[model samples]
Target: MTLADHHHDTSPSRPTGLGALGRPAEVRTHPLDMTSTAEVDAVRTALADAGLLGETVRFAFFAPEEPPKSDVLAAAPVDRRFRAVLLDLATGRSTDNVVSATSGDVVSTRELDPATEGQPPIIDAEFELIEDILNVDAGWLAALAARGIEPASVRAVPLSAGVYDYPGEVGRRIVRAFGFQQDHERDHPWAHPIDGLVAYVDLTARTVDRVIDAGITPVPTASGNFDDPAYVGPDRETLKPIEITQPEGPSFTVEGNHLTWQNWDLRFGFNEREGLTLHQIGFDGRPIVYRASIAEMVVPYADPAPVRFWQNYFDCGEYMFARYANSLKLGCDCLGEIHYADAVLADDLGNPVTISNAICMHEEDFGVLWKHADMFAGSAETRRQRRMVISFFTTIGNYDYGFYWYLYLDGSIELEAKLTGVVFTAAADSEYATQVAPGVMAPYHQHLFSARLDMTVDGVGNAVEEVEAERIPMGPGNEYGNAFRQKRTRLTSESQAQRSADGSVSRAWHIVNPSVQNSLGGTVGYALLPEGQATLLADDASSIHDRATFATRHLWVTRYDPAERYPAGDFVNQNPGGAGLPAWVAADRPLDGEDVVVWHTFGTTHFPRPEDWPVMPVEHTGFRLKPVGFFDRNPTLDVPPSRGGHCS
Candidate 1:
């Protein structure tokens, strides 16, 4: 049933929900929202008492329970359960478990398969142990000594271990390590990249498996310092401070996980797996997206050098995307009246670790939404545009990514990924890279992100169609031919839905409700407008191509399954070929008017320029979701004109 027609009952959810990480004094726990810190503690205690959690068990992911869409939409009495992916450090076995927060009873438990499925994410403790493992390795020390670098003078940066010709590490947990010549404590380690050295550190054994030294490349001596006044000179004094004040407070209200602004209502959630997700996104009490999030993201470096050839990092699946979220500050990170939600996630030891002020929510003004000047009537009408922004920033290795989800007044949704950070550099020069600094080359790479939209257009019955603008043939029995029409091909199956974006044709995918019709008798739908860029650039035979099959296309639609969450399978660490999206679509399930989930791959193909040296400028890549026949008219027509927002 459509929210507009079904009394649009929220759980009294006009306010935003609080996350489980931790909470302020004013915030209260919402059961259907994110898991509470108390819930985490209680669940962990229950598992340990029940012998489900041993000392060797580490938590790869722990967060609030996701109630079935049926129970949620049907408004069933949902139980409070927390889901977890616990890893046995001794045997490297990943177990998926569900425990009730109230009764402390195990709801379900199953051991996962790393060969057929995927490996669990690399826990934080493994990353913390890289330097220790590297320091004790004689092979790694010999390689560093070959480059005239000592153990104390260099830093070992932990990196994602990509799949390659490593038979010894088939079933073991491993993390790649790169050497950086660090001259001092304050000196930037990224500036002095000691190229030709690699360490395959096994986390299970707590030792460096082996070292791959291609050859000694000259280590760059130049400094890439952005903080020091000596290198950066002085702060810009010419710029004026821009202060934003909400005189009457923000338009959005947050009560626990629920967020409501104007006619839009939704609940926000955070976890150690996929950072921020919106649940039950409804506009004007009409359901649009039941859940939405960046399921997985892959950063494939194009450098083919032997030392760096296998450098594709699955940031979410392998690195734990939410674990490294930046604690946002008030003035620097955000402006205006902001409501911050903390994300309490389990650490490696299954203990609650709080990331305070991780999620930032605020409102912004965007020029004009609608304007018309009827000169015949000698009058004009214009209305301002505003959006509620829910965002979080994650600092992963050499890069920091800002995931921002904006809900506009025009009933449009946008997910913009703000990329700004230090580029990964190497000492050797290569054609597949850009020389950002003297003797240092930054590899040309692409950041491909996949957004999984588990859509509930009106209810559960939804369909997708690929719409393209096409020009009619001039020979179509016309003396003067200037006609063009839209070609909308309904996607009926998973194989047919594996599509790409074509900007030349102005292509877009619309998710429509086959059962719901608008006032014009057209189907009520939402359009996925892509900011089309190059997809995966690697050859079809490449390792990353097979592992990251989802990045090879623009759109993939599959019948909704509760277990099919991650795009590139669950365990991304050392994932083999044909495990994720490609494997899931082997059945080619029917998508015509079924419970379908849309996976949209969009990204930025970055070729670093000289200006992108130390700290790169923010590069943006995203897609927009706009209403199509979902409303009777301009929904913003009732929006009041901004007070004194125009000239006389």
Candidate 2:
């Protein structure tokens, strides 16, 4: 028997029912019914098992690049045109609002000519295609359910043009058209551009179910010492009353020299020193600050068209205002004031002494000064006088987390004015400079000299100390009587790196006494060293003074980390106890005893409101510094009166 010759047709005979050719074995398990909740759950479960849950399962749909082809393109025959007119007459009104159109509106015709039709058969065809696509997607979902997959949620977004331009309204329209309701209604649209139209079905097990039932109701009336009546009275507001959406683990504690606070259950904190608690305040409260409405600010610049312009104008305005408000409240000002003068005196060793006491202002004032400089730079008369006005301001807020306990969170603002832009001599170019003597010279590098201000938090409490100092080189300079020149190198490398990386570097500069000498027979001004104590020698006398110093101000804020489960949102870190402080205080070189001064102002931040949620509106508030004579005269005395009409 020739076994090899025996051939049996064993191609796995097709099933009696629908075979793989009709429907794949996998898809054959489920029917295309989308109404059943059980089917939906099954689909979600299947998707989760396949690791296609949440963001991974969204389906994106793309339109064909080319338009559909037709057999006839020339002018239609008389009968065909007439038929098109009849179809158009019937469906013309239905086309006004596609949202209301039904399956019946879909008209199939062999006329093949759209020119004669009111409902240009093309539109009906397009509608039918859309319906088919939707049905197919629904079937896929049903199949997933039959596989025992349950999806978290199915979100359908229309990828048609003009949909994203007005998201808030368009999103609502889509929801209404699709017969789907949003868990929470958002005033503005949340749609963003993707590669194409896609339905994202999130099927994650972690879903937020804890609902905060009580709405945030604004207090009709409140009064406090702060003039703007919007301030909630000292004892009025309480975080305990409001229910937080999510409460997490035990409270965390942050302790520092000037401030300390404990995070509580509601994401609020209790300030130990102030005996008050901080709550997340929203924009709905009293007008604590001056603000510009988005409509008033953006309308004039938008198009005049009734619908499109207003809608766009409002959306644009909200977005801009939100960003501006957040930055103004939370961002830090790093730029410091520059000072210069006529004849600065020097000490015996040629170091510049009596550095014509100039005031350093905050970044905001510096911005004003910069603007003024630009406007007045063209004036020949102003340039000749060399009369520079150095401007800066100081900001103070309750010690980090200080607002946690207090009823009224507050910040003080102070403006400082001084003359800057005056040119000074570099240490390398001075005649008074000398070679470094091995044993006698303290250090060849640059030295930072500062003075300490010791004060007690309370009369009975331990003395809390703060340091202030002026940075000046003692190596070469003339006293007030002589025309002395102070020489400083351009430090091309450091300057270039600093300029290029502006605003990105976070570490502060540490000032230390120098010990090395260069071949040029001159000592480097300030030595770059770790944050630690260094002795300051008087410009004239080689006497060294030992001073204990630390950072007086640090940029600290409350931020939420998505990973943490504790008080939901809380402050995570406070960087202190370092020698090199923030850049606002000059780094790279040490300051002369008179160059450094410690000043502070305060500020507050609040959560955004529903009105502010889509786009926040701009708000403004300012603080005034009483005449403390930090300057020789009232800094604002010389300021010219504002051009009458120019006041904002």
Query: Backbone clashes per model, in order?
Result: 16, 64
Q: After superposition, how far is residue 113 of candidate 2 from its true place, in Å?
A: 69
Q: What are the TM-scores, per candidate, against the unseen true structure?
A: 0.93, 0.16
* Per-residue accuracy of model 1 over 1-648 as CA lDDT, tens digit each: 000011111122112222342222122234457765666766676677667788788888777777777877777764677888888877878888888766667788898876556578777666667788888899988988787788888777777777777777676777788978888888878999989889888777888887899888889988898888998898888999888998899999998889999989999998867899999999888899999999999999998887888888888888777777888889988998999997777767766667788899999998888888887998788888999999998887778889999999989999999999889898888899999989988989999999999999998899999999998877856547888889999999999999999999999999999999999999999999999899999999988998999999999999998878988887777788787789889999999999999999999999999899889999999999999999989889887888866722
Residue 86 error for model 2, in Å?
66
What is the TM-score (0 to 1) of candidate 1? 0.93
Report RMSD (Å) for each prediction in the order shown.
6.5, 33.8
Identify the leading candidate in terms of lDDT: 1
Per-model C-alpha lDDT, please? 0.84, 0.18
The total of clashing pairs for model 1 equals 16
Worst lDDT run of 10 residues, candidate 2, spans 395-404
Quote the positional error of residue 552 for candidate 2 in Å. Answer: 12
TM-score of 2: 0.16
